[model samples]
Target: MTDSAEVPTSRPMDAWLDALSQPTGSPGGGAASGVMLGLAAALMGMVAGYTPDVPAVVAGTGRLDAVRAELLEAVETDGIVSARFGAALGLASDDPAREQRVREAAVEAARSVAELGRIGISLVAEARTLAADGNPHLAVDLAVATEALEAGLAGASLNLRANLRLARVHGASAAMRAGLDEEVGRLAAARTQVERIAAELSARLD
Candidate 1:
């Protein structure tokens, strides 16, 4: 077991799972989404490693390295932001500054999750590309990677929706708020594409 001060990623698998099993709302859905994204990235990198001679594979692997790093980092930061968001919500309802506090925390939380969702969604195109060009023998790994990306996208989008609702779109410019729904729709669409690809690969492999 890792020290209490360590983040979830720093802990051994069982310890991290135990922490997640606890009632704490943090290291929750958003963090889980980030982890899924990280998994997708790592798997993609492995697929790319099998075809390192391809220029595109080399470039894509480089990008995946960055994505994986960011996703893992977000796993910790998002958890912290979520914990703060919950704390803000738990403040006494009658507090004079409750509305402002909640709104700020909610926006922060929403933005954090929104960023994670966007990062996951950004990789969908790369995943599709890899499905055809990467090592054919790694099709199963590609399928799993795509599925993980889809799950990450779905999870992050749902978490974003919840945070947006909690804030009632507060503190956002009118245009930003208006576009939020459209962004969420795009995430859903991207995830759907990923899911379809994964299913195709699974069927072919079977």
Candidate 2:
């Protein structure tokens, strides 16, 4: 991990873009997915902000802003955790202790990425609800949020799959495997719902 002291909180957008464009492994796919999800939450908040000055819209916007903050923090946390997992993998092969550490870290990383997907699913559902009942003029904004949320969830799934492969190779516990499968199922269902809402919004636009 880039020294614990160097864990970034919030950098300029251009700086983040620059780092992601480089061939570095610290802020890889997992971090990118978190960032996208954070952006999606921010967009959802924006849509809510533009809706009629109702308590529900106002409260929902605040919650979306909180989700945005949490996801942005997750982006940094994912980078740090993945770097630690990478370090564990680089330990001497003959060291049984090292192998065990790697396995445990791999499982933890998978769990963390899966949580990101779970959070994205919540945002997707919220956006769908808003689109269904909120101001009609803001349908496009909600649709954009839904699209971004789905993309982020799909990206998280990719990261989750890779870490899951590592967990399988290292023989994760049955409970752990079952929990991960449940999360995956939830995400898949959420994605389906988001797609249906998106299609309905598209038809409205047409």
Best by the TM-score measure: 1
- C-alpha lDDT of residue 147 in model 1: 85
| For model 1, the run of ten residues with the poorest summed lDDT | 169-178
List pairs with backbone clashes in candidate 1.
none
Provide TM-scores for the models: 0.87, 0.85
Q: Candidate 2 — worst ten consecutive residues by lDDT sum?
A: 125-134
- Tens digits of per-residue lDDT, candidate 1, 1-206, equal 86757755545767767767778878788888888998999999999999877777777888889888888887889989989988887889888777888888877787788888878887887787788688889999998998899889989999888877877844545554556667688888988899888888788688
Candidate 1 segments whose C-alpha is farther than 4 A from its true place: 1-10, 169-179
Error of 1 at 52 (Å): 2.5
lDDT of 2: 0.79
1-206 per-residue lDDT for model 2 (tens digits) = 58957877657877878877886556778888888888789877877877766666666877788788888878888888887888888889898788678778888788878878877877875676587666778778777877777889888988888888888888777776668867777777887888888788878888
